[model samples]
Target: MTTSNGSSGLFISFEGIDGSGKSTQARMLAQALEQDGRDVVLTREPGGSPGAEEIRALVLQGDPDRWSAETELLLFTAARRDHLERTIRPALAAGKVVICDRFADSTRMYQGLSRGDLRAKVDALHELMIGQEPDVTLLFDMDPAAGLARAKSRATVEERFEDFGVGLQEKMRAGFLALSQEFAARFEVINAARGIEDIAADVLARIKARLP
Candidate 1:
C-alpha cells in the first residue's frame, strides 16, 4: 500500500457481507496476533478516527435512501481520508499490524449496487483518491441468506445497509467474490459456514504466512 507517511507493518483488511462473521474473525485475528507477541491495531471503516466516527454516524444513522450514492461515496471517502491520515498510517509506520474491518471493497459493492451501476466510478474514484490496498485481505465467503439472518439478529442503529435484505446481500456477496478474483494476490477466501475458531485459525495461518 502507498502513502505519504507509509508504514512498514502489514495492512490487513477483513471483508465480507454484513453477516459473514468477518468482524469477529478480524477481532480474533487481532487477539491471536497480540498473543503471538506482535503489535496489532484493530479498527473499522467509516469510523476509525474521531472525525471518521462523526462521519460514520451521519452516514449510517438515517434512512438507507438518505443520501444519493454519489453523496454517500463522497462522505465515505472523507471518512477514509481521516482514518488513513490519523489512524492507519501511523500504526503502520510504528510497525503495528492494522486490521481494518471494512475497506474500499465495501464501497465497491455497497454503493456500486445500491445506486445502480457505479462499479467503474468506484474504481476510478478509489484509484484517484485511495490508491493503496491491504497487503492481505480475508474474505469470509458464505451464503448470503445465512449471513443476513445473522445480521438481522444484531441490535444496532446501523441497519441502513442491512435493510437491503437478502437479494441485495446476494449481489454484494457476488461482488466481493469477483473482487477476490481481481486481486487474487492479496485475498484469502475463507469458509465462514464453519465454526468461529476454525475460521479464525485459517485467518491466522494466512496472516502468519505473510508476516515476515
Candidate 2:
C-alpha cells in the first residue's frame, strides 16, 4: 500500500472509542508484524514526535474543560502535523509499516462532533495542514458502556476525555461507525467485545490480506 506521498509503505491506524482495546490491539499487531520480519514503527497520535508529545500533555492531562473544542482542535492539528513530519512521513519513506494507535479520525470524532458541529472545520484544517490518511483504518467496534468501563479502569492521567462519561462514548461510537461508512474503502471494522488474543488474530488476518 503506497501512501499518497509515494512511499511504498502500509500505514495502518487503530481507532475506536476510549478503552475499546484498540491500543492493545495496535501493540499486538506491531509485535506480530515485527516477528514476521517486517520493519514496523509502532506509534500513537498526539504524542508520536517530541513536539507532539508535549502538545499531548497539554491536551490530555488537563481538566475536561481545560480547552474549548475549537482550541483543542487547533492543538490536535498541530500535534498531528508535527507527528507527520517528524515520525510518520519519515518512517513511511523508509518503507516501514507504521501502526498508529490513533490518528486524525479520533480528532474528527472527538473535536468535530463531541462538542459541536465543527467537522467541516476539522476537515478543512486537515486538508490544509496534514493531508495524509492511513492506508487502512481498523475500527474496533464494541458496546460503548463496556468500553467506558474498561477505559475508566485504566486510571491513567489521560482520563480527561473519559471524564466526559458514557454519553460521550456512545456519541463517539456512533460517529466512528458513520465515519467507517464514509471511508469504507480503507476502513475495516472488528468486533472488540472479545478476548485480546481472539481480536488480535482477527486483526492480523485482515492486515495480512491488505499487505502488498
Q: Which prediction has the highest lDDT against the true structure? A: 2
What are the per-residue Cα lDDT tens digits for candidate 1 across 1-212? 44222556889999999889999988899999999999999999988999999999988888878998888888998898889889988888888899999998889888876457887888888888778788888899999999999998997998888886888888988889999999998899999999988888888988998884
After superposition, the stretches of candidate 2 with alpha carbons farther than 4 Å from their true spots are 1-5
Q: How far does residue 44 in candidate 1 sit from its true spot (Å)?
A: 0.1
Q: Predicted candidate 2: what Cα RMSD to the true structure?
A: 1.0
Q: Which has the greatest TM-score?
A: 2
Scored against the true structure, residue 202 in model 1 reaches a CA lDDT of 84
40 in model 2: Cα distance from truth in Å?
Answer: 0.3
Tell me which residue pairs clash in candidate 1: none
- Can you write out model 2's per-residue Cα lDDT over 26-61, one digit (the tens) per residue? 999999999999999999988999999999999998
